[model samples]
Target: MTLPGLDLPALQPWFTAAVPGSGELRAELVHGGRSNLTYRLTDGTDTWVLRRPPLGALNPSAHDMGREYRVVAALAGTDVPVAPAVARCDDPAVLGVPFTVVGWVDGRVVRTADELDTLSAAEVQRCAFGLVEVLGRLHAVDPAAIGLADYGRAQGYLGRQIRRWNDQWARIATRDLPDIDTLHARLARTCPPEAGASIVHGDFRIDNTILDPADPGIVRALVDWEMATLGDPLADLGLHLAYADPAFDPVLGGKAAATSPRMPGREALARHYATATGRDPDALVEGLAFYVGLGYFKAAVIAEGIHARHVRGESVGRGYELVGGAVAPLAAAGIAALDGSG
Candidate 1:
């Protein structure tokens, strides 16, 4: 009848208007995404995934359903498998927020290290290599070719990210950490030129993808495109490799795992990507550090923003406390990445 996040009576009309015969459906929140709120909708015969920004103040640039919908829709005939974009409702009057409806993909999203253990070691290894290959594939796609030429500026990606996240930290900070500032300055100073530009997934991780249940190696859909943009491909690579850091575990809790026990080392993943794309990984060493540091800082800022909302009684869910705890560890980890110690 009613869901806390999904206002059914309000949305039914929009669904009827956009999806035809989809006004009557059951909706449930799909948990685990730390940023956007995702819901699964089914009308007993058809299913769709709906995404909207979390309720509370949000960074407009970081959480945009239109961008997510557009990117996925553009990539429909692409090697990067994504849930088919079904409809988009820009009028907030229908659901109290802009939302995107996409075809629901039936698959498993392994979100933690323990979830990776359920499969055999070989399966886990397949999952790891498969993720790497898919990322390579995504980076190989051209923004201009896909009509995404204006997704973002092509050059100065690494410098802009370092400055952007540092600026974001200033906006939603709970407290000041010297290490974060140090990392920001160091990263800014050592920022390298863009090696090349492509449509970056912005946030690429094992959990961000849906694997075919029957074949764990197959990436059925790459979900969560809220951060997709045109930028240096290595920026995405650095962020991807940063998750292999054990420090990220605190953010996801110990359940719904994505980390792999048999994951190839970060260097190995980078090398494989370089070979696959013919982009030398050596040229990116310094920029990788910058991007990785920027990743940690961005994660910390996001956590801090969520924590700030929770503190202001504006958050929904049970895990805001744990998220706040991660801000410190992530900042410390960012320092390590910047200092070349981690």
Candidate 2:
């Protein structure tokens, strides 16, 4: 039952030695994500997923697969809605780098806001509630149980974020954005003290979630644990706001128009999370600005890297043409807000 694409002769021994039916494994690429190379593997009747680093990226962390596996495995019995991790293969010879396989749950990715249009109002509300509740559960987990006691620094996390992304921009940026440096310095100067430490989803967004098609209210799995870290939980909330901010005119980037269907409005989502977590909404606003600035600054750095790659004839994808188009203005706005300008 080994799939046609995989090298059965080479993988047969390792597959057989690892799992009961590993010998019959077959795998096919699962398209949709840009970060990790994911594949769906099947052994006759049983199915699983394999995740690994992209083919030729200069990633600093060689153990991402192991890290993701460990994070998901540690939350196995918890309220977090994560796919079950089955096994991890760190031997580079097996797949050229570390990779992990997990049980493949059935669900559909919420890609665009139009997809939300098909759901009932109640389903939409439930999805919003479910997302917040799962995040709350993650933040509430005891990091000690997962051996992530040193996952991230609890104090001055915000200050560190401003500095880290600004430094990253200096390393990766190829073009001049008018105000990124000014904004970063100002944000750093005004950064408030650490609010509290909790597990933060560094890049939480609608596309990162898989929703049950039958019960749209339920989030079947929270994918992409690469950025999961120990930091201010409110930072995650702020990132969500930055992605879904309706105040920004969507006509310029079309991101807002595209997102209208997938995620709940920012106000509604904030209300839901606040009620569930018992956080005061008014008191969280100042922290929100810090996180928003951090989110946009980080995004701009990532986009600039992609744009630089494309400029150097190193990019392989189609959609990267829009990298600088969408990020530059947002980065400018972020800098403006930080500088106390309109």
Candidate 3:
């Protein structure tokens, strides 16, 4: 069977040459990912996961394979748990697009509330705190020590993020959303200074992580690094919180695991993160609303982008129809966050 975005016949020879002793390969698309296309590849004896850009990407940087490969490769020995980077193919002739292969992680991903339901209340709380601890640890890592000091420009990160997302809104918006513009203007005017720079996971949430099958409290691996960069760590926290909003439900086609009633609230997670990193609680409170608002802004743009791709028939998985409904609600939430009413 021919897989979309993967030419198995062309890939077999390259895989053999790249990783000796690997046998014939078979690929299966891993659903649920809305941006990049992920495939589970096995040669009967060995297994690996491949990630590449979507069928027709609107922004190359948003789905960069090389950037993802570089960050994951650099953080191999760090406290942050990540999949073993096996090989990277930058030559487009081989796969018709750049791609990266990592050893398949043996764990489970809880994306929707149905998946989270399998875990007990105690386990859910443990998992939530574990995720927060991991994020704190990630922000605490010294980028220079990890050879990622040049990963991104940390100065004026918030301003640049606003501009980037605003541009993205212009490109992917299906309709005029006045709240999005209002949110953008507010973020521009109230943009906070960098709350110290670190290696920020552009997207840090439960679904993006792989948890140990037997122990939900342990994170086996952190996948999806296409947006990893050095930036205000608070921005990462804000986005994480934004995903907890019920408004984000439609984007995932159902209730998100992050929004599970069993999980910790935004304040508890934020406090735990601050405690884990030895950050001042008062200081975090002072600037958190802006970051949360910014998170909503980013999420809205991303949802719109996915909807745009789906409308063009470029999206690879199910649930694309539900994503567009999230954009306006997310924008309204962002405005509320800034106004201190969310």
TM-score of each: 0.95, 0.85, 0.98
lDDT of each: 0.81, 0.68, 0.90
The candidate 2 region of ten consecutive residues with least summed lDDT is 249-258
TM-score between candidate 1 and the true structure: 0.95
Query: How displaced is residue 330 in candidate 1, in Å?
Result: 1.5
lDDT of 2 by residue, 1-342 (tens): 333223445565676787775547677776554456577877778888877765555435322777787778877887778898888888868666777778898897765556667777787778777877777778888888777777767777787778777776777678777678767777878787767788776777666778888886577888878767788888887676666643332211334322464566656676777777878866665346666777667666666755665566654334555666655677876765454342
Off by over 4 Å in 2: 1-13, 59-63, 245-258, 309-318, 336-342
- Looking at candidate 2, what is the lDDT of residue 77? 80
True lDDT of residue 243, candidate 3: 88
- Two-way lDDT contest, 1 vs 3, winner: 3
lDDT accuracy of residue 332 in candidate 3: 97
Error of 2 at 3 (Å): 12
* Per-residue C-alpha lDDT of model 3 across residues 1-342, encoded as one tens digit per residue: 469899999998899999999999989999878788999999999899999899885583688898899999998999999999999999989878899999999999999998999999899989999998999989988889989889999998999999999998988788999999999999999997898888889888899999999999999999999888889999999999888998988786688898777788988889888889999877786679999999999999999999999999997878899999989999999999999888
Predicted candidate 1 versus true structure: per-residue lDDT over 1-342, tens digit per residue: 667567988888888889987648888888777778888899889999988888777764768889999999999898989999999988978877889999989899888677787888778777877887898899888888989989888787777787788888888888877877877787788777786888889888889999999888899999999988888887788888877876666566654344454677877777777777777677555457777777777777777888787787775556666677777888888888877886
Cα deviation of 13 in candidate 1 (Å)? 0.8
RMSD of 3: 1.0
